[model samples]
Target: MSRSWVEAERAMVRRTRLRISALVALAITVLVAFVGGIAYTAMVHAQDAQVKRELRYNAQFGSPSVPPGCTWLFVLADGVIDDGLIPVPPGFPLHGDLDAARVSGQTIEREIERNGTEYLVLSQPSGAGRTVQTVFDKRYQLADRRHLLLALAVAEICGLLAAAVTGMGVGRGTVAPLAEALARQRRFVTDASHELRTPIARAYTRAQLLARRAAAAGLPVDHRAGLDKLANSIRGLGDVVDDLLLSARLNEQSAGPDGQAVDLAALAEAAVETEGERAGERRITLTVDRPAGPLVVTGVETALRRAVDELLANAVRHTPEGGRIDVRLRRDARGYVELTVADTGGGFDPVEADRLFDRFHRRPAGPDRSFGLGLALLREVVTRHGGTVEAISHPGRGARFTLRLPAADPGVVAGAGAEEVSTGFR
Candidate 1:
């Protein structure tokens, strides 16, 4: 039981780690993207302001005949440069006449291209023989865009990192309480089982001794029967303790070390034999049918044995006197080996069939005499082996419990023949 808690804790830790990492990455990405976009927008606006200021200065100052400043070397009249004015640079468009600049009595402007750079142009009449022309370089605007994009990329990376860290914190915070609850529950089960086992064993032994003495003394046989009944009840309690301890150990070893290979077919046969020996008076017969040669599965032998034992025990306890119990181990269509325990007993509620594997669940329509742990324990065993357990039943018909296990690698282990009763790996 403690082992189960530990496994849960480990799983929680792993999940928390992953969740936190992802969240932190996501948060950081968003933060960086938002900050970088704002920064880029501001940079673009600043570049635009600078370009517009330069254009306004040229318009207020002069024409192509005179340079307003070093930055404004030429201004045009309409679309052409005035005569006797040299071209400021080879890429600059020739200045135009005042008449063209005054067309329609309104300014007509457009962006122009020069020397692989963008320039914003403004054309308006300054006065006679002059037209105001302004051109602002757009290279700085392009450079600002590049810088902004680079900043955004950097911000995105930083955001991702921050998100990862924050995610981890959140995951850990969320899982801590759950882990603690799991640990406490496991401890309770383990401690309770351990404490109950000693008293149950002692009670069973005392009752048996009393019954034997009563028979030897030839006292009232009916009184001895009562003692016998008490003994059986105590024995049943012991069985429950055994199941708890077995579950605890199996859960621990399942994660600590992988189970060794054992012949599942052999195990099934042995379990059948044991069941028959104990339940013969009930007229329960055990049979083994195996078409698949030796079938080896990876799991703790004791746990698997207990699981098989539970299935057979359930069949025997519920099967009517003279009823047949069939135990078969064979390969399924999916290539997995299946161990099935079928009994001609009072079948369970079809609706309750699904809940049989749940711990502490008893069918209201079926047997009133069950601890409800048998099928649950069986499920744990099958799960540890990376297998599955299922129950099929119908009212007034027989019931079947099927356990499916992954087929063992033939190269590593071979199937044991039916003749061999026991093959201990230990």
Candidate 2:
């Protein structure tokens, strides 16, 4: 579950990074386009100014009663337009059609023919009548705008690539720690289970030998009591082993394995009955509240049953002899199936409830108590089956554990609830 949560977080971060990068790229493209447009406009304006200067110089000097060293021609008119080109001196350098000559209050634009070359005429204001000027077409400025646009396009591409690379790198780095933590946690459970199996087996064998020897001697020994203790110890070891293996298997299954419908209600009742028999004359009452049909779930049946059995065993072990115990299976408001186990023993330490499911955590140690693995195993079983367990306790009010699981077929209606009233005895 934690692993899935971390992956979800990484996905969100990746999406956010992509969106921000896109926005940045768009902003850069717009800014570059705007700057390029301004630069192109400036270039055209400067070129036009130079063309006007040349026209004015020619108007003041050297051409057909014009000033010396001024080579271009200028034509100014007020009303009617002229289609013919203005005559120019011998040395002008451009060629184009001269269209018209015009001078308004502050502007003069005219067509000028220079050395038999035709060009468009432009006019700017002078002392009295507007000064005439000629402007060539803006082919050079247009070429510059095209080149600027190409460069900006390349830069935007590079920026997007850089952003994507950086976001992925950072996201991977952030999730590395979470992965390491999960690996260590799984390994700890597996190694602990394997290590405890040896001592538990040895205790069971020794207890069996003692019982056999006592029975042969006909000493009226408490062989059953010794055997029960050994059995409980062995069962505790099995619980731990089951939890560890189940955790590992679920890890694999959730990754890719397929699951089928499992009837949890039936599974729970069978487990409770079996565990109740094991309790033998201990004052523990077994109550099962189940619907008529299957409370099916999409999961491995074995894993789910083991989890329920662990919870039952935990309640049995913790509750004092003759204390009431109740087990209920019902659906919650969200249509989730819940298996609840409640015990009316002297309640547990409220503060310790938080670590109830932790491995090797036992409560209020006593001489006859077994190893502290039952709750931990229960937690593993539920987790593997995609379920949740929560414990609520107080000083005197007994402990309650609720295991919530999603229903396999939401279309199935839940049956009526069941209540049990019975004496707590083995």
Candidate 3:
């Protein structure tokens, strides 16, 4: 395996592990928060119930001077106050509630905050127009609540950390099999393509020789035509095998330190030149527009060249006779090298645009139908080099394919002034 392929696999594994860790941490965080919220709420409710029970009991039966701890009592009879001699906290013994209970002859209860603590007060008519009131302090109960909260916060943090660690371990084990499977698949493709290339080449050569000999021997027109068609079919098969091999190799390539700066403008010019004769036979006009300076991008040069050639060849094949194909190369404002191949041909359905680059996807039955490997391979090459490829078309409106790659450092392109020349082909 290439270093780039190994690095890509490692990066994928790392990303998967991180995502798993994040999900685990999130689940744990939500669980801790929910449990903590419920615990705190239940504690507060229990404390309120206990405090109310104590206050009601004290109001009904406790003496003014001998009330329970954290409790105080007061009595009002015939407008005479009977508060205990013991010192009372500020804002104690709510006289309004006492009077309201005496006049209404009913129980009254309320909670008030004072003296840096919460107090629950209850007032009720004892008998014969007598009113009794009791108060309970909630400072101790509040302290208990704070302690529980602090413990829960600590537990939440610990749980999150544990979840993240566990998730990472689980993720590594989970993704190992997937990574191995991908490695095996890539190896199989490489091996199979290598095994098939020589045979396909030989078959193509023999077919071509047979056609040439049949023509030279003055074979009948029909026999010669059949041999020519056979030769063409073998040639097409060979091309498919070559494309498969190139696709596998490009997948393993990366724009690492081993990559070289390639002039995209020059590649585009060469592709157009290579396809010029075929386009001429079809009476299709081929043209290329490039910047005066080399539009440089970092990648494997042969791969980039093949990608460019595929784009031009695809355009030539799809375009009708007398149609025009334009190739343009330039560095966009975003500091990326952009190459576009636009052809005036019978464009495909707009819905099929996204699937155009899918390997072996069947095209609409027409003269433009293809084996469907070229665009897929082109996409593989561009993506491996950190780029994007897209197609735009409307049926009968022609199609445009554009690929953009990260431009190499300007300093490198500046040094290649020797190859900076304008190229234009008709």
User: Which prediction has the highest lDDT against the true structure?
Assistant: 3
Q: Please list the residue runs of candidate 1 whose C-alpha ends up more than 4 Å from where it truly belongs after superposition.
A: 1-15, 31-133, 138-165, 188-298, 309-325, 331-337, 343-376, 390-399, 406-426
Candidate 3 on 92-210: residue-level lDDT in tens? Answer: 78989999998899899888899999888888998877899898888999999999999988998898788778767876777867877887887788788778877877777788889
TM-score of 1: 0.57
RMSD per model, one decimal: 7.8, 10.6, 8.0
* Residues 280-397, model 2: lDDT tens digits: 5786777887777767666655556667777777777767777767888887788688988888766677787869788878755643556677778667656755678898885675
Each candidate structure's count of clashing pairs: 20, 26, 0
lDDT of each: 0.70, 0.60, 0.80
Error of 2 at 301 (Å): 6.3
TM-score of each: 0.57, 0.48, 0.62
Summarize candidate 1's per-residue lDDT along 1-426 as a digit string, tens digits: 454667767777777878777867776676677787788778878877776677767677645565544334344444555522744545554344234566645565666677777776666666665566565567768876987798778767767766666666665676676777767776788789889878778878888889889899988876887676667556656765765665555555444214467788887876675566667877677788986567887655666777888899888887888888888888777868888889898878888887988999876555667778889867876887889898999667689999999886764464323323222111
Two-way lDDT contest, 2 vs 3, winner: 3
